[model samples]
Target: MKKVLVLAEARDGQLRNVSLEALAAASTLADGGEVTAAVFGSNAAELAATLGQHGASTVYTADHSALAQYTPDAYTQALVQLIELANPDAVVLGHTAIGRDVAPRVAARLGYGLVSDVTSLEAGEVFVRPIYAGKAIQQRKFVDGKTFVTIRPNNIAIGAADASKTATVVPVELEIKDLRSIVKEVVRKTSGKVDLSEAKVIISGGRGVKSAEGFNTLNELADVLGAAVGASRGACDADYCDYSMQIGQTGKVVTPDLYIACGISGAIQHLAGMSSSKVIVAINKDPEAPIFQVADYGIVGDLFEVVPLLTAEFKKVLV
Candidate 1:
């Protein structure tokens, strides 16, 4: 049987939603073959069961203190062994920080072809990815051995409950080697807000916000709507906010159920990050703002007046 391997990601012993999405994609491509998922961390067996709920038939786990914190060497070594043992037709992963770092390394080690940031995957000789910062879509296929693909999150929907199935956990052996690079410490961002990548709704501010305080209105509106906050490249470049909040060609990509652009000019770079949003609402004083072109609903008006009204209306609806 042609097995398909999916690398799962978890935090604090819980599976990431994107990892489940990867499992969903792999299951579809498995073609009746075993859909196996591998997770590295402590108490990963429980996470393996979660994968089963998403269609993973077998789950491989490697638990160790070194695996607790992301050490590329340790993870690569573990995954390398798993791939060799399972011999999957294709290995899939979430295009996150860890996946981006490890997928290429795994491909290089196996001397196989890799397609990164795939927005869509189908059972064919070819794979698809975005180019020119999402301005273009390109498809390429490998004539060589097994293919490796890292899928961008939010591009695909996750699987619903299948309580009849449960993922079987298989433990893996590990060889701890001296990593050339050692992680000294990980300083997490202090923000208590939901991660923009995982957020279902994102309300982003841009140059139209006009000031650092301008983000305050966006925040108020976001709070009422129960959404995460984001910023545009133009807003970040103008020093209205930190780069971490920036979303554009050079920044993090987000695809939420609803993406609200307040004052953003909607440059191609900015659109690349958020064009995938299911429902886009653009509020700009200038009707010609490029962002309005893609918006499902456009409000050409001053944000200062528009945002407060939105916040108030949403507050009432939410309450």
Candidate 2:
């Protein structure tokens, strides 16, 4: 039996979906032994019940002014201390911004083997991860000692919450000091309320959208479906959109329930980010585009004409 601990994430007081996914992944690594979760910041106690419902036997929370916003110094300090206190056999975290930054720091500090970007797990310790820009698969395992892994967002399924379960919330304080930099405030430049990583649906555009103004139509379609808007590197390079909206190997990897590609030529780099989506719908004039090969549905036409039609139709069905 394995004991697992997960570093959960939260944003704007509410728990991020990836945190629940991390709990689910932690439960998997525990294999019926024990699963514990850790949340940092002011909302830890407030979020413990939800963590319990998802199978966290114990929820550890650290409340500190430095942890109020994510500073690597404060977060790493707290996580390393928690791991030491719990002495868990394995550690799990969501493959998100915080996880990407802090997991390696903690593992390096603790001298543990760390596996990142894990999409699937079989036989507990055996982890399956994507390599070479999603063109290949790599399976690796930790033969002995503690195991640490970061699971990709939307790649793992979450178990339904149990109302009967209760988790013990422990408040911890870390000796966080020595600040090289402090994030006093954060300024966001995102288009939608739904996070691109956790969105169930996405409407992406490429250079074929012509200009930044072209994205307006895609946004209309996205608004109707309540989907996030994404862009290819080509569009970002052309200055048609911000890099935050870019979806490719160089950008964010997403696995939404539905991905609609508009005017994208389907470069390998772009495909690497969104290929894992449950359903792909490609809209491009070229019937020979590589995206068609992976798309469950394809529309060959001008996206300007097709997108508005899709938006109007969806308004009748979904909105």
Candidate 3:
């Protein structure tokens, strides 16, 4: 029997969906044993019930001033203590920015091997991770000792929520102190738009969009669908969009439910990032654009004319 522990990550006082997805992965890792969770900082307890609904039998919360905002020092300290208390066979985390930075510290401090960006679990023990820009997948497993894993969001299927199941909430005292950095304030890039990494639908522009003004058309469509806007590396390199919105081999890897590629030529690097999307829609004037190869739906047209038409049509259907 295996016991799994998941770090229930919260952002802006709200629980992140990836944390629940990680809980789903934890259930798989548990292998007929128990699944537990932990949330840190202010109002941590409030998030415990959600973890419970997602399959966590017990939820541990650690509240501390140092943990109010994410700092590696404070979170690492809290998680280390939580690990000691849970003594779980496996530790699972979402592969978000905070998880990426802190999971390594926890593994190193505990002298455990860590697996990052795990995409799938096979045969109960083998973990699958995409490598070399999705050109290949590597299967990994723990030889001995506690297992530490960080799962890529949207890859794992979140299990059914059981409202009947409730977790026992426990408070773990934290001694977090002497943080090297504290976030004074968070400056958001988008004005309350959906977070790109977790968005269910994504509309991405490419260099073929011509200019930053072209993105405005895409943004309009994104707003209509309540989706997030992304860009190909070519678009960012051409100064058509911010690097933050870039999606390619060196940029963000996204696996949304629907991915619309507008004016993208489908460079291999760009495909590396978004090829795994559930449904891909590619719109381009060129019939032979490489983007068509992976697209579930393809439209051959001028985006300037096509995008507005799509936006108008979608608005009628959606709202």
Scored by lDDT, the top model is 2
Give the per-residue lDDT digits (tens) of candidate 1, residues 57-121: 88888887778888789888888988998889999999988989999999999986788887776
- Let me know the TM-score candidate 1 reaches against the reference structure: 0.94
Enumerate residue pairs that collide in model 1.
none
Q: Which candidate model has the greater TM-score, 2 or 3?
A: 2
lDDT of 2 by residue, 1-319 (tens): 8899988888889898988888888877888899999998887899999999999989999988999999888888888899989999988988988899999998999998899999988884689999998779999988898878999999889989999999999998788889788997798988646799889999999999999999999988888888899999999999999999989999999999999999999999999999989999999999999999999999999999999999999999986
TM-scores for every predicted model: 0.94, 0.98, 0.95
> Which of the predicted structures, 1 or 3, would earn the higher TM-score when compared with the native?
3
When summed lDDT is taken over every stretch of 10 residues in candidate 2, the lowest stretch is 184-193
Among all windows of ten consecutive residues in candidate 1, which has the lowest summed lDDT?
186-195
**What C-alpha lDDT values do all the predictions have?**
0.85, 0.91, 0.90
User: Model 3: how far is 183 from its true place, Å?
Assistant: 1.5
What are the runs in model 2 whose C-alpha is more than 4 Å off? none
Off by over 4 Å in 3: none
